[model samples]
Target chain A: MRPLTETETQTLFAKLANYTGTSLKNLIAPLDNGPNADRYVFRIQQSRCYYFTKTGKFRLHITALPILAEHARYKVWVKANGEMPFLYGGHIVKAHVGRWSDDCPEHQGVVVYSMNDTPLGFGVTARSTQEARRLDPTGITCFRQADCGEYLRDEDSLFATS
Target chain B: MAPTRTTTIKSKHATNKSGIQNSKTSSKARSNGSSGDGVSKKSAKSKRTTSKGVALGSVTGKGAALNKLRKKRRVYTERELGIPTLNMITPVGVEKPRGGKKGKVFVDDRESMLTILSLVHAEKDGQIESKMMKARQMEEIREARKAEAEKRVEERKSKLDETKEGLKKKRKRASAARELEGEGGRREEEVKGTKALKLKKTVSFA
Candidate 1:
């Protein structure tokens, strides 16, 4: 990814809002240009993630999902108490939904959060957020696209508890 | 005449050990010969390669040796070397040529912006404090909501138990009244009379 100019960043934010149907402001911020300028990446600081791309475009990484959770925009909620395995399993059935962003479109990328509002990963909406909130209760609301716990599981074998 | 004179002079020098040694070491062995002893045959081969006839005087002269030198042309061209020549006339701000192939350009290794920041620029303060504060605020709100939900559940459970107890007491009193009614005609009439009297008394009290 390449570094995105302020204009490109703003445009991308607008595109994201349009895609997910939510207002997003102060959810992301760009750092000042320095020696590390032109590096396309986003870092989750406290509550915000900064992102850019090699093509001078705005881009997002899986890790940035958590910071975006605070916005509740373009997001889906999963049961927080569920085991880590359920998250990495790449399924987002209705049983997993605790809540979701209002009117999130089907097939759009979304930040997946736990009931407690911590970001668990990213997913694609299988059902609209409005529909997921309605009476239909057995199908998937979102498709698991990426899981943050996958990295944890990868490192698990490297440092066994025993 | 000049060519014959050069050959005779070179032959005189070739008989010397230094000339033989120099020629022998200079030319690499092309093939192993099965002719005579290895040293003699190797020397003969070296002599053949170095003693090619020059049109002029003896090969001892530098010019004569140069004429005898191999005329092999290079296989690649200056443009094919892929070295970028400095463009002095162009403006400084313009993108410079990065040497590779003509149509192909080499791009630097690009990574996701977040990956680059976390891996290399971890220490730099990129408005992190404010972000943390916002997250903390969210966490506090979440905790408050959870606590409130739990409290509501507890209150509902208590109310439900109270209602269940009241229903049980009402059923017991009704069963006792029915048993009294079954005992005798006078008793049943007395119970009905008492119930009517109690209802009248309660209504008047109200």
Candidate 2:
């Protein structure tokens, strides 16, 4: 899950438009990558996970599918982080290559819908990094995957309005 | 060699004590312990692995901004490992690897892509299940092979012991035969007795 170079990006966007029946602008819209510097945002349902980079050669979203979830233990490099157990049973559906996820609708959590090739928000939850700040020590960013959309500050939490 | 006269001085206690020898042996043992004993280092490590205010990688208990940074830093992708890879990112200024084929995420058909994505998702789950079952099967095979090897080793060892015992008995019997030859070699008196006895028998018969 390397970051797309400008050329790769263009190619991916082209592919997205080709497959989604829309242009890159139509599919991606204005998720906004301008003031954010290396940060890129795309809608994956209500869930919004944040990733920061001094280097942006690889996409954080792609890495997350294998690292955070159960089916992502495909990479030998990732198994070293002591996270192989959590992701061992989970497998990622190659979004473009072939058809795979027909019978296992209940197993949608194991499947990842790519933003570049398929339905971007197919099964993504509307979570933020705020609740997930407890896992970070850097204090520069945070994440959340809660259905309630709770944002955590320094020793404080702000609940989202319904 | 010149000191032919021997004089013995008796201590307060007549008994010869090995206290000095015992002390030297204990001192040697103590020196060995100081250099080789791992007890001190083990204790120190026990103290360090136990203390924990926070886990650096857990991404929990850190402030909002820090949590996000840690998550990004620990990110591992196909690009990092430099594998034959495919991904979609904003490719505006990012250069391609030297001589590597530049790939793009293209949609020739949206409806088809959506259908394909769903299919891909299903495929990934089945693949994981199949992989797990395969690993289990392989492990069972390895265990069976190991058990068979161990059984063969034990059988060989027992056979060797039996051969050694047979050799031991053979050696003992050969050694006893040599002892008997040594005993019978004392034949000087018997030779004289044999000659004298033969002469007396002939004289008595005459």
Candidate 3:
């Protein structure tokens, strides 16, 4: 676990900011590459952000949900339509998508939230914002990349940072 | 290219179907163990006896023939111990033969029963042990045969190598002999040429 250089840290931070559609400074004001450079840990105050290895992007952790909840630019809200359990289980359809950010394009990562604005999980847009806007009720709008329940079941903090 | 989302759902469904199959097989094995009869017989019976339709005389209601069809089949335990009521009904100083499933009967004599059970147990153990011994003997024979074959192959290879080596030496000697003969012929030719030169000199002098 080698410590990343300043240049490497800046590059990673830039990539993270672009992928997550968040300001670099706002996400991690004082970026700490931790002891190991191979793994990067960014914190907004104390809550750790979850990075989905499959997507190669930082996900808004269940802990960081409160902070990202107000930032509607990166959130997509879906109406359960009496299928709230299914939505929580990480199944989302076009009919379930009540509202979403207009800027989210096809393949862009976004935070999935309930109609009540409770963060559900992280999802990737299968259809473009334009296509999703015109999507049929039965069409699939997005696919869940990571569910909040996954990390919650582990019962361990992401990292121990005093 | 962006990955499709439907593949995950399809894979999950496949896993679920496989899981159900595994559970069904386990339950089938458990049923067979408890029933004493193999599942093949049970399945065969079910396949052969399909109800065509309810008969007109069959009673309808709680006592309906269909209710019996819906009822679960009872699995009987092993018929080792004799019936208790039959023993009580039997006259004093005389024991009746124990009746068992499908026309099979066992003697009520305790000594004969113990001897039969012991013989059956010994035969089963002997069969299993004999099978294991046969397998071990066959494995040993196979290994011995393999080793012998490998030894024969090595012997043949060595024999062939010796013959090939001898042939190579013979070829080398034959080539050396031919080279010596060629050298002798060339020397003889040179000697004849020198004699001819001497003869020419003598004729010129004369």
lDDT of 2 by residue, B91-138 (tens): 534754677765645433334444444454345545545644565566
For model 3 the local lDDT of residue A92 reads 71
Q: Which stretches of candidate 2 lie over 4 Å from their true place?
A: A1-162, B1-122, B180-206
Structural RMSD, model 2: 43.5
lDDT per residue as tens, model 2, A1-162: 233333334333332321122122323233455653342333221222323233422223332332233322111111122122213322222212122222222212322333232222112211112221222332211111211111222114222211
Rank the models by lDDT, top first.
Answer: 3, 1, 2
> Which candidate comes out best when scored by DockQ?
1
In model 2, what lDDT does residue B100 have? Answer: 77
Q: A78, model 2: CA deviation in Å?
A: 11
- The sequence of per-residue lDDT tens digits that candidate 1 reaches over residues A55-106 is 6455544554544555544666677555354466667778767766653454
Selected candidate, larger TM-score, 1 vs 2: 1
Once fitted onto the true fold, the runs of candidate 3 whose alpha carbons sit more than 4 angstroms away are A1-15, A18-22, A30-72, A82-88, A151-162, B1-206
True contacts kept of each: 0.00, 0.00, 0.00
**Weakest ten-residue segment in model 1 chain A by summed lDDT:** A39-48
